[model samples]
Target: MKKSKISLETSFWAGQEVENPFEFLEVFFEYANLDYYKETLNHFLLHTNKLEAYEAGTPGQTFIIYTAFRSFLKACFSLKTKDKKLKVRKAPEKWSILGQASLTSEEYQNPFLVFQKAFDEKTPDEFDFFLCEITHLSLSPFAEEFEYDFITPFIHLTKMLDAAKIISERGIKKNKE
Candidate 1:
């Protein structure tokens, strides 16, 4: 299978170092088993040159790509975290039920907004919506735990998809040779 060579550039926020957003996204999508998203991205790459050809003559191609990419991102955001175990920490303070509820609600809402902001600014040529979705996921409260537990397996799958996109794009170029 061919892989996509679409590379994502990483950004730093608030002077703190950030992980490669692309890597985080790759893992999130893999963990969720979003095959449709993968397939659509693959299809896009397979016809990239054709699609690029249309970029100037047909404005609809842009929307088609944008909408499809957005849908792919939505799929990633909808994934539920399966792990429920709470890790123990030293000197933990007790909290009321209401406090816990507040924290959970805040966790849910903040990440979504952060993701939306990130998604809105992402350039379609460099980053996909799926990557934005993963960026949001990585910022969530339990991302560290999730990463520690599942990042390895997720990386394996993402690498396959990445390779496919790269190969497909390359194949298109080779055909012109």
Candidate 2:
């Protein structure tokens, strides 16, 4: 019988059991504690993957999606000492044209304006492949933190926003008719 090797990164980050002991945890902690690394981890773990459930645009899924994102943002950026909360405000009307907040803010920066600038610098053609890859929906959760997978929530948020916009437009059209 063959035994499986334990995950070093998971064991180190998630405090899971590992076969080999990590000797330099103090050294590792220094890098892991940095804001840059934390942001990098957030970028990949919390904002990368798309969820199939969200993409399906199924009823009642939107609420769960928003809940996940609210929990994720609160968990990652919440300041327990001062009780500061990262407010996930609704994106203003003017910002709707930007390929939705779900995809942009994750990679370039947390703030929407910075992400807009970064996204604009690159032509759409440059990102076609990358965007296509991001749109591929999978049932699997990308990464778990604080007891949940972080990325899918943001994906659901974007999908819900799009659905809301479509419904609003249809209502306006009906009123005009």
- Model 2, TM vs. native: 0.19
**Candidate 2 residue-wise lDDT at 116:** 36
Q: Which stretches of model 2 miss by more than 4 angstroms?
A: 1-145, 172-177
- The TM-score values for the models, in the order shown, are 0.23, 0.19
Candidate number achieving the greatest TM-score relative to the actual structure? 1
lDDT of each: 0.33, 0.31
Q: Return the top candidate by lDDT.
A: 1
Cα deviation of 77 in candidate 2 (Å)? Answer: 27
Backbone clash numbers for all candidates listed? 9, 0
RMSD of 1: 20.5
Candidate 2 residue pairs in backbone clash: none
- Measured by TM-score, how close is model 1 to the native structure? 0.23
Residue 157, model 2: lDDT of 30
